[model samples]
Target: MFKKNKRISLLNYWTSRYLLTLFVGLAIISFISAAWIRHTTFQNRLEMMEFLADETVYRLTDTSGQNIGPMGSIPGFIGNRDRFTMREIDPILYVVDTEGNIVSSNRPAPPGSAKNVANLLDGEEGTKKITVTNEGQESVQYVVKKKLENNNKVVGWVLVLEKKENLTRVNQAYGQLALLIGALAVLGWCAIYSLSKRLAHPIKQVAEAAKQVQEGNYTFDLPQNNKEEEIYELVTSFKEMANKLEQLEKTRTELLAGVTHELKTPVTSISGLLQAVKDGVVRGQDASEFIQMALVETTKMKTMVGDLLAFNQFAVDAIPVKVENINVNQLIRDAVAQWEVMQDDETVKIQMDFLVKSVDVQADVVRTQQIVTNLLTNAKQAMQGGIVTITLMEKEDAVLINVSDTGRGIAQEEQAFIFERFYRGENKKYAVRGLGLGLSLSKMMAQSIGGDLRLIDSNSSGTCFEITLKKATTL
Candidate 1:
């Protein structure tokens, strides 16, 4: 019957809350504006009263230079029977001898101060705004009083009595205006809620669809068909994610087949080499050659196993580094030396520049060396037996260890997911073969030690990997 008003629904709740706030806010503003206008009108009335009070002054004195009109008329109530019309409302007029005596009142003054009202003109007068309260009543009145003058000396006052009823009427008028303002505010809020719900409905649908998409359903589409730029971008990003998922599925299938093939090659070689030896088909030289062939196959098997271990570690990754102060320059040199041992001097060259004075870094030395070694290996992998330059320096609060190579660098297409597991780069001439775990392990190791590794520069010359770490200043 009444929409149940269960105190919640996006529309009902938000609109209700907004309406409450709007009503309070508009009520205050409307009350203030209405009150101000009423007050300004009241003040104008006072100014008019002031003007009238100032103008009405006549003298009453005796033979020493006294005029007698004060005896004939009482201030602005010049005629004895003059009736007050609302058009000219102002000071009440009265006159008496210097001795207090009742003379005239436009209306009978309130009884409480009737006597005082009769004689108030006798005193010296300036314009005095006075409040009158009677003995047993709560209602009050304002009297604006000015002196009646005899040749510029005040002989009497012209007094005006305005009742509390007039102020009550002004307040009632303001109250009515406030009610109207409240109604208008409620109506305005309803309109806003209706319009905003229409505008926001599409967004809510998109949000639900996005959640569904995140949970592996890429079949969702935004219902909004208009040119809303942000929603359009959202839809585009979702479509992109869907496409990426499709490509990943295809890559996953290919990887499975490739890995099986890779495994079979080594297994087949090992089985054949062992069987040949067992069948006594070889003598001294042949046996040794077959034995080396089996050993190489076993080595490839070991490499594949290591890649699987690194992949598993990445999945549940551990940051098992004991932080200690180590010489940054020395660590780089050591990793470079290891690579130098693995290659002939004529085959490839290693260059080093230690930029800073001796500085210590909080790092796991083994992992740090591994990261540098992996980057150098990768740099060598991309080149034709060229020079790999490694640098270490302190920058402000961080230590930057850089490895740059001069070789055929990574393709722009391949650089993005270079850190992802099993992302083996394309190699030519079969020299740069790997199970594709080196960069991923290095990245994980770098992050574990509160550091980061990133490719800062690359072009026709090989890519540079910058490993940034907080300099261990105290150690």
Candidate 2:
């Protein structure tokens, strides 16, 4: 098995990666800068040496090579002496003849150095630059040579030699560059760390909040004043989800209690009535009535159980729906007529308004009839006596079946949840005996047949529900 990777906080992850990148990038830049600085410094020093060599030759040639001494300085050449002094360069000066013999000197040099200088004299009469390491000291030196001329004739040479380390100030330049790079690196790390912390803080809080929510704690505080738009949206959406889950949890608890009470009531009634009859508490006609009451309770319980099972099957898409073309007007009329016959109360009247004489729709016949009957039953239960109107209208490749009732409409607050399973409105919770699955089941059945059932309107005046089905195409 592979080893699992260790988890890390966002702050550490981002900060470490950014810092590594920053340092690596800075390192590359520093390397380039240092290389360039070293080259430039050496070039500038070489130019200075050339200038000194030319100046020395100009002074010596003016005297016609006569006033030069062993020290290689013009005895009265104040300007030349000051130029060398101002530049602070201590270089060995030499005058070599055309025969490659040393003529004058700035200071006493080793025999090896004098031989190296002689070997460099190639009889050329123009200025030339060279780099060579002294054998005695084993240190590199920069040498510049200029020809000494008199009356436009070749005379000798003036050579100025300075140690390479003394000519170039690369170390000082590197020191300053290192300081600047360090400061920038420190500042960059601070900015990256601060920004990363700010971004990671909100995400950590959200993770913690999610853990709390998993533990059944829906209430928690989160940063609402985040300046980032995406972070603010994340926090806002999570809060809304938690609130919705909390509402669903409360509804679930209520539904469980309601289910227990609804099922237990009928069972208790049946048991009591049967026990009464079995104990010989009633006899003859009374005993028979008592037994009948028990059977009625038993039937009610069985109906409730059947509804629960059907709802579960429909929810899981386990029930098959056979859709076919049928005359919607006739189907509604027949369902209303059958439902009317079953209702014992005559005051509740149902009327049909057929806007189209004949309309064919693709739907499941049994499910359609069941949805209409369920709506009628709910309408009857909503009022003592009222008119339930069923209207059929055809429009734009679809047919609409509207079931309206002139009864007490659903309350404003409860209308949104009428189609939720096991959700009974406050007004009907105590007055009605049901599992609150009628509208929910009807909607599921309607949708399974490629149609929809929805509440179009509900108010204090009345309520209206519309069922939409696809119209059959004529070949």
TM-score of each: 0.74, 0.62
- CA lDDT of each prediction against the hidden true structure: 0.68, 0.83
Residue ranges of candidate 1 with Cα displaced over 4 Å: 1-16, 34-41, 58-70, 73-116, 119-138, 151-155, 171-209, 215-264, 276-284, 314-319, 344-346, 425-433
Task: Tell me the TM-score of model 1.
Answer: 0.74
Query: Per-residue lDDT of 108-201 in model 2, one digit per residue for the tens?
Result: 6666766788878876544445666555446667677787765666666787777777766667789999999999999999999999999999
**Reference-based lDDT, residue 68, model 1:** 41
Off by over 4 Å in 2: 1-18, 39-82, 85-131, 136-169, 211-215, 266-303, 314-317, 320-421, 425-428, 431-433, 436-475
Model 1: lowest-lDDT 10 consecutive positions: 55-64
How far residue 86's Cα lies from its native spot in candidate 2, in Å, is 7.7
Query: In lDDT terms, how accurate is model 1?
Result: 0.68
